[model samples]
Target: MLRTIRRAAFDQARTQLLSPLSLLAALAMPCVFAFVLHSFAPGRTTPDMAVGIAGIGMLNAVIVDLLGAMSKEKVWRTLYPALGSPGGLVPVVLGRLAGIAAQALVSLPGTLLVLVLAWGISPDFDWFRWLAGGLLLAIATTAVVGLLAYFLLRFPSSPGMTNGLTGILIALSALLVPNAALPAVVQPIAWLIPQSHVMAWTRGGDIPQILIALGQVVVFSAVVLASLRRLERIAREQSVPLEY
Candidate 1:
């Protein structure tokens, strides 16, 4: 299983990270947006936006990679065998995500460097805190990845719908601004988003807040996994063909 996961991860890394254009966009767009926000937003808000944007960019890139990995088997008309293989498809999907996560980690430092050099902003925490913060971000993002994977498996052909939903999640998250600045109705919604906890943590929220984020992540992941199981069952029964 570990070997399968590693191979899947490696394949995912090559397919997504080796694309020069995608890599360029992933590395450049966050810095560009940060520069714009720094120019326009009040000085006090720049750091918050910088962290939010960097986190968003990293998660966004990896989530897209996961989606691609999920779809590739279907694209190649190999979904049936892949899913029917020993230990089922979950491990395979996770293996692919391990690779995607690796790529995201590789790109993150450059993104942070851009934040520091170009936007004049970066997280100012001790090493341990930074590690904890990264864990929180990963937990939150894995929850999201689970949700998005459910969607991808549920509607294998509708990449646009999945992409649109991803956009909506980002909008509801603290990636754009502080949750307090969001409308009252949206604030509750933001709490349910993993990225919201990330924003709060970035701004120095305490351990209790981290607990809440961890809880949300666990709940979201559980729900997503259950849904994926059902989707896999249905797909196997219906024998859904390769979807272009």
Candidate 2:
């Protein structure tokens, strides 16, 4: 399994290396984020800002690297045949992982560099801890985004609508607004989003609290992956020859 995943990763990296749009999309988000966040909303550049920006950076990276490419694959009829190969699901999924990883790698550091050096903010680097927390956050968001990608791939009638809806979800799920400031009606809903906890942790919340949030993100990812299992099976079953 590890060898399969490793090969999938290498293949994906090679594909992305040639994808100019992937690199452009990855570059655009964080640069725009740093400018906008630091310029207009400097007051909001607290720990939460770090986390929120990082979260979006990570997500956008993942989407550009994985979901966006996956859409192209579906459109070009490359995905289903790949899935039909032996030990296929793992490779397909891992290939997605391999492809989009650059997004996370590039976006996170660039955003943080802007935050710490340019913006003069720091949330204690601690590489091991940061990676642990980041891995959890990244994986969780991937699950949600991947499930969304599946549905969109299955039904591309309105890809624009799908992307728009997802963008809206990412904005709200960001939890940028202070918990106290949230409307009473939406408070429960806001609290329920996995990204909410991720936002909290990003803001340099209490260590214990951050761990709890990590726990929630992990649990939520598991829930999302579990929920998608049946859908994946059914989608594959009902799917026909790949679209061109």
Candidate 3:
């Protein structure tokens, strides 16, 4: 089962890179936001600015690879038949997730390289302390959000609607802005989204905050998986398919 999923994951990465939508989105959104936000930021370029761009990149990771891919399948009604088969959901989920993982595998190292070569920023990647936590959070964020996008896909029956919802989620994440700047009610709402927390942690902003973020990821993951399980059971009963 794991092997099948891993194989699907491999195919997913190859196909994702070939996707024109994914390639353009992966690069363009981050660069454009990076330039615009950096322009408005008080300093010529602040750490927050860099973090925001990187966060957009991560959100793009979810958008292009997982949410986008899932919607693409369902938009064509390709996913439902696959979901109906045995050993099918495993590969489908893993393959979609594998594509999303490819985004991070591309971005995180790329960000570090750009910082070192182009920006002349230095980070202690080899440090006994930094490597473990950094790698862990990066993986954790990707895994949790990939799963969330899968569940969200279940809610959107059409590709366009699913894609649009993801874009809106990214915007409201508020990694580009501050919580206090938002209306009081919205601040708590923003904090509820993992993208907001993932962006904060990716920028090397706060550990305690990210720990809380990881907690949210774990909680949401459990809920999404459990819900998916229920949906699958309902589908098996052939009882008019409510979760869809």
Please report the TM-score between candidate 3 and the true structure: 0.71
> Which pairs of residues have clashing backbones in candidate 1?
none
TM-score of each: 0.83, 0.74, 0.71
Those runs of model 2 whose alpha carbons end farther than 4 Å from true positions after fitting are 17-20, 39-47, 122-135, 157-159, 218-220, 223-232, 235-244
Top model number, lDDT: 1
Candidate 3 per-residue lDDT over residues 9-98, each given as its tens digit: 776776676676765655566666655654665333334444555555656665557766665666556555656777645456656675
Give the lDDT of residue 132 in candidate 2: 50
Tens digits of per-residue lDDT for model 1, 108-212: 566666766654543453444445555566557756766667666556466365556546666677776678988898899888877788668767777777777
Global local distance difference test of model 3: 0.57
Cα RMSD to native, each candidate? 2.9, 3.8, 4.5
Residue-wise lDDT of candidate 2 within 117-137, one digit each (tens)?
Answer: 666754454554455545556
lDDT, residue 59, candidate 3: 60
The C-alpha stretches of model 3 lying farther than 4 A from their native spots are 42-47, 71-91, 109-159, 163-167, 199-206, 239-244
